[model samples]
Target chain A: MNAQADLNTTVPVELIDEFLKRIPYVSEGITNVRLLDGAQRVMFDLRPGFENQRDLVASRISEIADKLCLNYRPGSSRVLVKREALPGSYRQDPHAELQQRGDIIAFGRGRYGFGPKLVRLIEFFEQRSREMAASFQADPYNFPALIGADVLDTCRYLKNFPASLNLVSHLREDHSVLQEFSQSVRWDGEQLAYDRNGASGVECLLSPSVCFHWYRWLRDVELKEPRAITALGKCFRYESSNLTGLERLWDFTMREIVFVGPAEYVLASRDRLVDLSARFLDELGMAYEISTATDPFFVDSYAVQAAYQQGFELKFELLAPLPYSGKKLAVGSINYHQDFFGRSFAIQAAGAPAHTGCLGFGYERLALAFLAQHGLDQKQWPAALDAAITASAAHDKA
Target chain B: MTSSPNESIEQRIAGAVMRALKIADPGSSTPLRMGSTPGWDSMGHMMVVMELEKEFNTRFPPYLLPQLVDVEAIAKTLRKPA
Candidate 1:
């Protein structure tokens, strides 16, 4: 049964192809396959998806082992092993109690609305954000929440995040064309048939991150000195089953302060931001841990880049325990772009590619963390947050 | 149910790696370390592991693949009864 026990000669191509076809792996993202150089060299080009594609790969490899009579031993692989997927989904909210009492409302998957108390809680975090930015002397700026599709392409957002990119398009100007396109829309049944032949092509994409504004502004511009800016904006990302409450969202608000300058300056700024964030968390009296992390937005080759980023400690997240799922959630992050933005935008600092870094805080996530730790009772909340709520309630009465 | 007594762990590992790597000269000194040899790439490593499991009737964890540097390392991990 062991074909070519010595392996000195080549195996037949048909058998290898059969092994590949029989392999129990999801072929959704595979773009290429090479089976030469032995069965061990079988590699498939897999694009990144929201789920851990590696798990599927490992499972398939195990199945291949079973068929080939290969043994798959544990404790002998990569250090980054997969963990048990967290419990709950869009259908199963772990914080159903919060939803029942009207503390938080799930508008739908990737969307949520807050009641009065949660709003006040979010407002308290807003004050903390203002204090944090003011301390950093961040030059505040706001850009259109929707970025032009051409602008996104120029920024390499499309290349890096084609899976998550949400393009904004519109119907054709002619009503007759709209009527014709209406066939794509299902009144009784669900249909996505939209006749784009008459409609305008995708003109804009929802902004995935707030820093796109700063990079787009500095396009073709040379900076004589370092520039710092703080921005708060709504951002969008497409999540699969990973989409939970505030932990993972299709759309959420991000408060960020980005710095672009020489590498040394950017590194120093990032260190300072990390230190400042730690202090801000301390001020709020929230228990958090600053841990090295990476943006889960990338896959395949980009996944390697993400691993490299994590290896170098370039991205750090402040994780806090959340009430839902009873798991720690990354509430904020500090990132060192390492000239990624500068090279993409033609931004030069000191006659070299500008090194960039950013500090981003998620207000909604913080609110959720607060609720997780402090619970739904306002009186039982942390002092500063409770005080803010009391003052706002008093003001409303007045 | 068992490999032939003459078929040693080193022989099995070397055979699997040689097959995966396609080294014509068995005695040729091209280090079997990962990222060092042409056949020890990530994909090759997985294949060697699969083949090794079958040849030696031993299971190898995913993390252990990176550490199984060469024939010697695989032999040591396989640890067939002397």
Candidate 2:
């Protein structure tokens, strides 16, 4: 069997299913493999024994797929999962007040270009993140905002939060190929070919969480003691109906303090982190309440787990009022993933799956909350926050 | 398992569902609706299913998890011809 039968093979999904049944141990050896474009990329679910054998299975699938003439790109199979997303091309600009105040320039709805005050506020949050991590001897890292789509899939992100994902694509470089593909689909004013036939299979996704990058980086690393890492990055999440000021956004900055270790340590660290957040918010004089979150992306089938988390209050959020929207907001959250990340990445702690926890701060939302509550002027800001901002500004000037 | 009558079984299942979901006033004939019931969340739904299985000595398939929405829906499934 040679791949020369023709350029077109089977649709990636069908080809994947066909090959899935042929794997040595389909049920136990493989958890899942979601084909992106049938050939370009796919996320694999590795069972226990095959954790280190991703290359072998991927190569075999590609080899068989190539012989079947499916245009298999050797070594292109990636360990991730994602699905086709809704067409997300919007042209709305930023909120007017933010633009006038020079706090941010509107690039699009949910996308912003920060001004000096906002930048300094973000820096303030970043510094706070460092301090929070330094207290535990955590190493600092700055990971790219864009992550491999396969990586997201491997983390089961595609299964849980598919609705909120934004896939990044680029125009086909070959002009003639693109011209032909585009002309084939008619734009009757309302319909768009967004047919992806002319576009590249998405190579990367704007990360929705900072912890994903850190976990992916820490994949398969042995940790004896509780290890902490602080990371800063721009995270993007498509807010369908929830799109509004910093309250809910499309592109925003996030600073996270992640801990991975034995179950007791991770859970204990998360409790301490919650206390740390409470202290920090109190210091800033931000009026907020810590409440358990009901809505979690534990995937649809695990409604029981979602309810359990809610019932036990495993997810806590620091809620504040969104100034412009007048809606209560969750400015911070402390979560215990409890070996979910470890299972996804094959990471082990003390010869068993590691437990993980993270604290996420919505930096931009915090800034907006501050402005909303304190009236955009730094002069009237709370004494402690005001002094810090002043020092940040003076240090920058110096 | 023979019950005193059909009404007794119906009442028992309904009361059990209500209790498992942690909803008060099991006597209220509100027609427990899934996704809308105050405590009939996903977890509660699973508990209701398990309790129903044990009470009747019958197992419900996994796919029917979403289908067993209300007390009526569950009662109907239980009454189906075995």
Candidate 3:
């Protein structure tokens, strides 16, 4: 059904892109949304039966626009690095090929199981990142998928991103509670149903980002010198209706190189990572742009938090083109925390709260973007990536 | 509900800060910095901004939010011609 709403106020041109990104999450029934009359109106393509809810959806959209679109002054989003499309590159749908070849299996919304080809691609990206980390003498570590809720609280994730949190809970340990849960649990066609009383208080959450665990691991420690650590871990964020294909996921692999030291050292490390990342992407011959970015904060706090982030130029994202869609996906980021985490965790360096920075690459998005630009054929891939894949395959055989 | 004519911008700002933090007046001499002061965290900073806007009847530009780290900064910003 066709439904549309005109926002009462005009959203600035600069904020329109960000406003559109947040539209899908406003309502599950909003299948798609498009701009009308420049940025003053929005047309929503609704799911069947959602036409009845049009006014409600429109009101929510207006509320969001008021909070996120009009309240903040736009910061200059400077593009730090840009690469043009490869000479012979052409747009193709890699998702279809991956699905047809059983390279990826969709289990549910925003969840997928990958076959060997995609898995190998992810490993290749990981190895390259590890090589980069090695150049900085960064110690490698592996962290568990779950992080204590308290750790996230300390990171203030609840304050800025309350909407994206995914809490983990289990049945209460009492035998009676377990028996009650076992007796009552059943599939209700859409979701599992059970007695709510049997569920325990959630003490842990799926880790939202990999670097936070590194900060937690080094909590309250005094560093004699600057320390760099690299880790690969699964991170989870609830993206609601915004999740699609490999671009946005509820659970994804992230490789993070973290620096903990004085402010100058951490900032230098972030800058170095950005330079290295540009060279690496150039070697792969991908079309990409690295630019200043802000986090997707909850709408209530979006204006203040995003303004703060962009005002100070605290984050930069490495965005690769989605060839077929004419859109760009952020596959990596470089962020400087500037003593935020150090003070939270009481980590010390140079007799003061340590500054921190991290560079993270989402392996799945990177591989997907690579496939979309390079195509399913290995021969079409960049020589550097081709050589790495070939060498990895040879090592597997040997 | 008018502020005392003799009240300094610093005093007005301090009152706003105290109201936002829900604390007793820390007196005029006590200096409050964003990260150093108790309860003046990010959320507290936002509340303080809101209170200052209400107290002064003026809105701050978003970029200026990060620069309002201390009373002096806030006073300096408010003193500027809008």
Candidate 4:
């Protein structure tokens, strides 16, 4: 078929149907499908993927709301989840204090900011905790404490995403992409200096979610066979001049993984995740490039403990080139953290230290990039992309 | 993360002091007052107090709330040895 026809092709619903069929016991969780102007969205039950049966149906709905910029007029949407009864106390921002206890905060930015959509987002996070619980098949009490501890510390950007250094070391020695294209940073005391009190100067630290994820993994698997998939909302240092749309955010979201195992299996798994993530982007009709991340400290900084963080930068950034920004933002990344975390966490197996690796996706970046590719007008958007999104919604329902 | 408890109490109070003076930065070391800083008016003073409390990891007596007016005074309340 020609290119135009190919572009116009309606992705067969069968493909999405087939995709859902393969996953065990997952049912469609979507509610209603609506289009606001050119923005298309489908509300879905943001059910926790875990067995605790924690309902996040509303949280899932807000993610869609944010992605599509839906202004969910109150009284229009009903949440199965309640807010004021939430166990934790929120610091009151008098200027932005939410009046209603059950009200969910939405849009940390924008006119329709901080409402049910935001509430749903928090609900989504709550559900995610439940999902994590499901992954380990762990008990209920073990779940909330682990999830709630740093839940409030949730922010954007993750710095020093402590990875498996030994694994990355092994990968660098082997992978061509890593060996050549890695970037490094060095502090001259001029370029970067210590924040004496965190007190004296303004310092932005990356999200602690990755580190927290590591802490949680250690708690669960306990040194034998450790595995975890963590989704963390992250913020990064961005130039004010470079900021435009979601392409450049002082903050962003990053989903990273740390798995410790045999080298061969881990390498294969990394490739599989890359492929799976690519397929996900394809379904979104977005283009991407996979590049290796370069952390200069991965090699030399080992001798000095603090040197590693003093000079840290990403080894790889999966970028989706955009026309609007004339540049690409990292949408996803698959990093091989050979042993930094394993050694730090003292994870061992069979009396030998384990090798670890991580795969990450910048979920928000991916969504924004997809939006960039598809054009704002829903009518002009490719049918395949539309179909895939619809399928995502429908899949939720099933 | 790069903070030390011994680093001058003045440095520690910078963030909080800025909130009370309502000044984000005086541009130089010039002192800031409550109405001077962007977004720091009467309404923001509470947030400033909360921020100061969290950063110092200590709470001020509720009656002392009115006493926190300027940078120097806020500095006095901060534990010494800045």
- Candidate with top TM-score is 3
Residue-level lDDT tens digits of model 1 in B1-82:
2346688666666777776667654464654665456656434555666566667666554434445778787777667443
Per DockQ, the best of the predicted structures is 3
User: Using lDDT as the measure, which candidate wins?
Assistant: 3
Tens-place lDDT per residue, model 2, A220-261, is 888767789888778887754346656668987778889899
lDDT of prediction 1: 0.66
Tens-digit lDDT string for candidate 4 (A264-329): 545655666566555555544556666543331111122121111111211345677665545656
Give the candidates in order of TM-score, highest first. 3, 1, 2, 4
In angstroms, the error of model 2 at A57 is 42
Residue A260's C-alpha lDDT in candidate 1?
A: 90
Q: lDDT per residue, candidate 3, A226-252, as tens digits?
A: 999999999999987778888889999
TM-score of 1: 0.64
Query: Clashing pairs in model 2?
Result: A12-A38, A43-A80, A80-A150, A80-A154, A81-A153
Interface RMSD of 3: 2.5
| CAPRI tier of model 4 | incorrect
Q: In candidate 3, how many clashes are counted?
A: 0
Tell me the tens digit of each residue's lDDT in model 3 across B52-75.
888998877666788899989999
Q: How close is candidate 4 to the true structure, as a TM-score?
A: 0.38
Question: For residues A1-398, could you state the per-residue lDDT of candidate 1 as single tens digits?
Answer: 00111122243442343344333233454434455466554455556662356455645544443443322121211221122232112223336767898877887777898778778877777777777778767888997789888778876678766667777878879888887877656544433655558767888888988998899899888999999889889999876434667677889889898899998998988777777777777666566777776554333333234434543456787887653455677888888877767877899999887888888888888877766665666666557777878999899889
Classify candidate 2 by CAPRI docking class: incorrect
